[model samples]
Target chain A: MLSKSAARAFFLSGTLLFGAVFIWLTVDTFQRIPAQTNAGDLNESVVRGKHIWEENNCMGCHTLLGEGAYYAPELTRVYDRRGPAFIAAMLKDPEAVYPGQRRMVKYDFNEEQISDMIAFFEWIGRMDLNGFPPEPTIGMAAAAIAIPGGERPQVFTQICTACHSLGGVGGTIGPALDGVGDRFDRGYLMRWITDPQAVKPGTQMPKLELTEEQRNEVVIFLSKQREAGL
Target chain B: MKYQSQKVAYWFFATCMLLLSLQLIMAFAHSGFDVLHPWIPFNVARASHNNLLVMWLLAGFMGAAYFIIPDECERPLYWPRLAYVQLIALVVVGVTAIIGFHFGWWEGRKFLEIPRPLDYLVVVDVLLFVANIGMTIWKAPKMTTTSIVLFFGLLMAALLYLPGMIPTDHQTHDAFWRWWVVHLWVEGVWELIMGAILAYLLIRLTGVDREIVEKWLYVIVGFTFLSGILGTGHHYYFIGTPSYWLWIGGIFSALEPLAFLGMAIYGVALAKKGGRNHPNRMALFWTVGCCIMSFVGAGLLGFAHTLPQVNLFTHGTLVTAMHGHMAFWGAYAMLVLAIMTYALPLLTGRKLFDTPSASYAFWSTNIGMVCMTVAFGVAGVAQVYLERRAGMEFLDVQRELKVHFIGLILAASLFTSGIIAFIYNFIRYGLPVGEVEESVSAGAAAAAPAE
Candidate 1:
């Protein structure tokens, strides 16, 4: 067996050297992030939001800074994709936003708490993470869709693409609209877009409730869509 | 059993098995695959699963120490009844923590999820265990290299738990200290415990000289400390820690495998050099199997993502789950089973090592775990590519990977079957009885080949 002294010497030096390196690393870690960027400010909204995040145990499903469960999407860049308003809307009524998912157990948070959650996500969005959770490809194509009126793309961007994909560039909650013009006539488009549940009961799509003029305008725009290269 | 107090170790091992079964059950609930309690939900189930795992392994370590220390010191236990009190306290704290997780009364930290109040309770329980083991060695007429090393490992583990309790509000700061408990325990002091246990087993099973086996133990300890301590940097990288850790963590953690490699070499060399004469060949299989498999799991698989470049993609993914299952199974779980395999025969005066079920338990568990690792590997790789690389939404990737859990569930069932068989054999042995026979002790001395 190793003599008692030799064993002790080995243990001591190894531990000392290792501890020295660890301390150096810890010091470097503390100094790495600038004061403004790290999660230390504890501003009223940020502090409250942090508590809400912990109290609700949001990390149980959603990952923040890639440290939580992988069952939900990485929320490190959530503020960028879904803006604060959309996040607020989703938090207010999650079942209305997207349905039939066991993940993201929605709790009843009031307006202030929702605002705090938004502030927390906004803060995380600002952290200097080195190119984590690579940016999404959808809606990032730079070329805005051609439209007959300015209101058409605005309506599509604001409401429609939350559930529908167009030209293979949106959420997958609803069907893609690349060939909608060929598939449906103006009358059919008007009926479907204005009151979806009237035509297909149990459809997740809620009524758009557009004016008659606006309905006709949306129909014209949607009916004009052909296959991308056709 | 050699000492009357050694019977206490049986109840502790039984607790380990019961808790392990609970962990498995909670794993299903966490995945929402449970029909019984679909409402158990992810947060509570995840906490229970992870916490139960740590608790059971702690129980196993305590049992292993109780069984080995008296024999190595060549004396009866220092305080026999005190061990029972410690075990009961450990279980009470564990159950309360599990119940607390359900009510959302936990500190939300991964691994160290028990709230601050329970954290204090856990500390008290550990102190009791440490003091009991400490006094045992103090009062022993003789102390072997094995007992002293085990004592140091336990004591250091108790000291290290304090760092996790360091209060911090900063997320980065909290994560930094949390790892001081998690990483240091698994890769640092636990290796010492494993080394000491392996040393004790080799000395007894291999009929090798205690001197020869323990000299190798020194080398293993040197390797573990040299690499494991600095290797904490690996977790520091990209958790809002220093950019410098990318280099430091990568370099040091890469060297961590050498320690496991040394253990594998030490185990195989001792087994080969010592004549193939131990009657309980199953124990030898588990001992050598633990060494080799830990090299693959903790050494090779851990090295797979230790580098910052790879960890950026693979951290917190199922790839981690892959490494975790194999490494914990190979290193700690098999080490416990190895001791039980060796001790069970002596503890209960039954030699079931040569039975068909005994060999089946060893092969089936190892094979089942390997298959489970492969399934996790495939899912993790696909997740990294789709979610991280292609920038697919998180829930989308999970949907695609749902099919992979089918493979995981099937493999886990096979793994559970093996564990059941092992536990059945343990039960059939029908508890500790009788004294250590004279002939066995005489044979142990006479068969010391190197001496």
Candidate 2:
């Protein structure tokens, strides 16, 4: 038999108590956020990049820090996952990166803007987000098929894996590279890695912007992908 | 209607219907309708969709307040003209913001995408609304619990808008404060508004004793803030906030359902206890329906993911949408509709209640929304498995989820039909031109045996 006065007291006291606690926690959170999110990394470029992010309403499609529209991929860890080259290239032309898939509105950002965006994402990726974007626990075991190559090169991981699969651990857009070394020679691998369009007139793979050394590295790595043991 | 000033609420409800239609169209375009993609891109459509939902709901709340305050206070509004001016200003600001969103003239935040200049205008318009309502209550011969609770909710909602406008360069800090406006309004003060409105409706429609209804009102809203204030922690868990938030958010948010459950029980029990059948049976259906659905939608479904463990996967996925669509539809959307249905007949002197279309509107919208939630849930769960658990590529998973969006579209079409029926009923009722009748309260009249 709760009376109205008692109910009113319950509401007033509970709200004030919890509201105060929330404000105190907010203050404490602000204190810790500087270190947790690396507030010092809030450089001019990153700030400008944030402005670009908001100005373009990127969150309308993509998510950051596990907030925003779910139409696009979560981009909080994009810098770490894709690396600068891939992000820069993708920003330059989104459809070219993921052809015939979900379309991204191309902003035609200049080099400086691209770099700024990269920096912003880099800063975001480093934050301690209570272990968000959790590691894919169930699929990682199946995807970790042993590659014939001793060790995959950085160029292959950062650029080639975006479209192509290596030991079933990457994208499905391109053919699997499990026995690629057995199929193609070093010369062809080198040429194809340098420019897929040149090797095949109408290949879906764009001519990846890679340095000579990175191209060689990718070619060597692909050439080692033998069906048999390395 | 007892007061001439109550007529102003009709215009606000009309605006609501208009905005709601526009919102549905934008939502369809945003959900991969190819023909409108180039004309209304995803961002444009999304910003408009979210903004329009907020705008229309605000209008509904304002309308509900205008209609209920005069009836409760036993006096006419202090400045009825100002209510009209406020509505016009709000519509103008809303139209400008929606147009600006298309041209990339926006702040670009989700739910707060109205441009900075328009944000100021919105604040001014809301202030005018608050002042008008406040003055009405101030000059009233007597004050009721419902009027006071409703007024406080509106005032606090206006104040909460400021936190989102706080300037921030750091993304984490930005998110932390943005939730102050979004979370606090929906979960916190808005519940106060919902509670008060439900109290008013239950009092009038069910012919329940005002003492009994208002007493429970305090308890329900008491439970609301008791849990909801700390429930803001749930948003903080993964937004670069501290680890402590995980425990705080998980524990408190788990309790959030109790408040909603109370609401459901309150509505059902009062309807049974009153034992008086009002002529406006449709209004009672909506009122009771809002309560039950809010529990299932906001209370139970929200609990399904509020935990830190499950949320670790479902965060930023379509799962949130599953909960969100029904929660808003149940808690806020239906609350507004309940009040609209209750007030419409009295406002226009139309006996359109209990019509077949009215019942069809109720059933179709509820069933359609539930189906939509199921579609979102299926897509979302599949997405979590493929993308989060299995680490499939984002696009690969999205391609897989396309079929669910088709299901969503189907459900949305049914929901839209219900809305059309509701709007048709509204139009048939015509305008709020009913004469001011000197009579007993609606509850007392309903309680007496029908003549």
Candidate 3:
């Protein structure tokens, strides 16, 4: 049904394009900045963190940015998103929070390496990465404060319900925090609010779209909602 | 132009399109270059692309039905109010699904991202139309030029989107079936759409032989869908799929571009051999631009990373994004413009748009598209070199290329402007407006020697 000439033309065009663009991209690639620097950035925290991260093999669950495996959530935003205390606690007790997951193997990371890991997260958190940061603005000030309100639950539904459960109504792709205030103090909430990395490092929760006021109000609402009559 | 019947579908379709375009623009603004952005991920982008395509396709299909269904049936739209309900349902479901995606409650497929709850709604919308379109065509004394192409394209698209909805565990499996929805819809089914609209516009304006045009249609599209649907294999070469996929995908995808190139060369040639001396040139502009873009975006860059060997080096890079960006918006969205071109004139009493303003819009859209494509491609290639193959860490790569990436974003912004200009021009002349004299036309002199 097809003409031989047209078939040949197709081949000819394909070859020409292949040869030309491939050559061009190659040359262009070489001419650009060297593709990567050596992996051996000798900074102490980086090396220590590298050892700890690899020792832990964080890629088993969390992705680093978009690379690695995706069984775990992304750790690329962990430093700014999670706090040291949470990471330490999670490592200390695998099933304390995530009893449902595969029992996380306890890695024997030393204090210095833990600090380095925290440093790694801190470094990544502060990095001026574009194309991320859901709203892409640095905080003006902590607008959320300790607030007393019944309206907080409504605000929580509007903002946090994407992840959190409210009266067992929302999705459980995330954890249930029905009585979190019994364990977590205001400081814990504030750190989690500001950047969870300040409290628990490498948590899977995305930074909430909370204004300081909204976050505080929601926190107050969440903090106080212990059973109808606890 | 209420005509007592078609007004409801048209308005609803138009409103949905305007909103979908806004969502797409915002998604682009935030997508950055990876699937791991703090806000949205592969899941959200998948939803955005799928939902946007769905809404646009629904609107385009409904618009076509409203225009040509009457002529086909030798009567006004069968139950225009029914069509109107379909349009409203499409908007409601489309808006809800898209919001669900952005707000993060969507299935994690690359294309089949309609919320599971709303899937039945989509089926109903499709069913409503199939009955209407089928009946209109069956009932007609004879189908018109445009109705045949459109009826086949949209109807088949609904059929093709099904395989993608199959439940699957592996991402690779999902991606495979997803292409059945996404790829066939664009290259397979939508080609008819694009071809049908082009045929209709040329018929309306160029005074061409419909038989000749129809013949071209018959040959041109068959090859594209045949090769094109299979060509979707290219996407899977690197996603941990089978090895044979490499050769199968690579060759077919390479063939896929040839079809568009053939269409481009042939389209311009046919236009010339056909002969036209008309103003209101944006119709022609949209058609020609669609082919050129389809070739460049889907063809050129698509091959750049289709094979497993190449995809290992280029997958998830900005280059893939560039190709999709151009191909989706440029190929299909612009075809919608082409359809609007003819339909507007026919809808309005004016024979054509005021030439000068249309020219500005045309230039803006083309230039904007070109800028966007090139910017994304260049930045994407740079990213592949720096990140994937080079093995640079994310932050380091960002620090190194921040300025250039910013420039690329600005270029993206400009492309957005171009799209706005396109819609603005569409609204101005395409609407029933009192207009004045001079017309600007492109040299429709045929592509020299169709060989």
Instruction: Give per-model TM-scores.
Output: 0.89, 0.97, 0.63
Clashing pairs in 2: none
DockQ values, each candidate? 0.36, 0.81, 0.02
Worst-scoring 10-residue span by lDDT in model 1 chain A: A142-151
- For model 3, state the Cα shift of residue B148 in Å: 3.3
Query: Candidate 3: which docking quality band?
Result: incorrect
Q: In candidate 1, which residue ranges exceed 4 Å CA deviation? A: A1-8, A34-36, A89-93, A135-164, A169-171, A179-201, A206-230, B32-38, B434-450
Per-residue lDDT tens digits of candidate 3, residues B1-451? 3244544434644664586576556557344454244455444554565567757756875776676566434555666677777777877888798788766455544455566678878878887877777776777687765577678777887787677667643333444566667776776778777777766666545657666565666566656765665576565454334445567667777777766776777667756765555565667777777767767776666666665566655554556667777777666777666666655654544564656656666676667767777776776677666555443333344445556556666666666666666566556644443331113111221211122
Clashing pairs in 1: none
lDDT order of candidates, best first?
Answer: 2, 1, 3
Candidate 2 regions off by >4 Å?
B33-35, B437-451
Q: Give candidate 3 regions above 4 Å deviation.
A: A1-230, B1-9, B28-46, B71-74, B144-146, B350-352, B429-451
Candidates in order have lDDT scores of 0.79, 0.89, 0.58
lDDT of 1 by residue, A170-216 (tens): 55677777778888888888878777889899988766545576567
Rank candidates, DockQ, best first. 2, 1, 3
- TM-score for chain B considered on its own, for each of the candidates: 0.96, 0.97, 0.86
Candidate 1 displacement at residue B230 in angstroms: 2.2
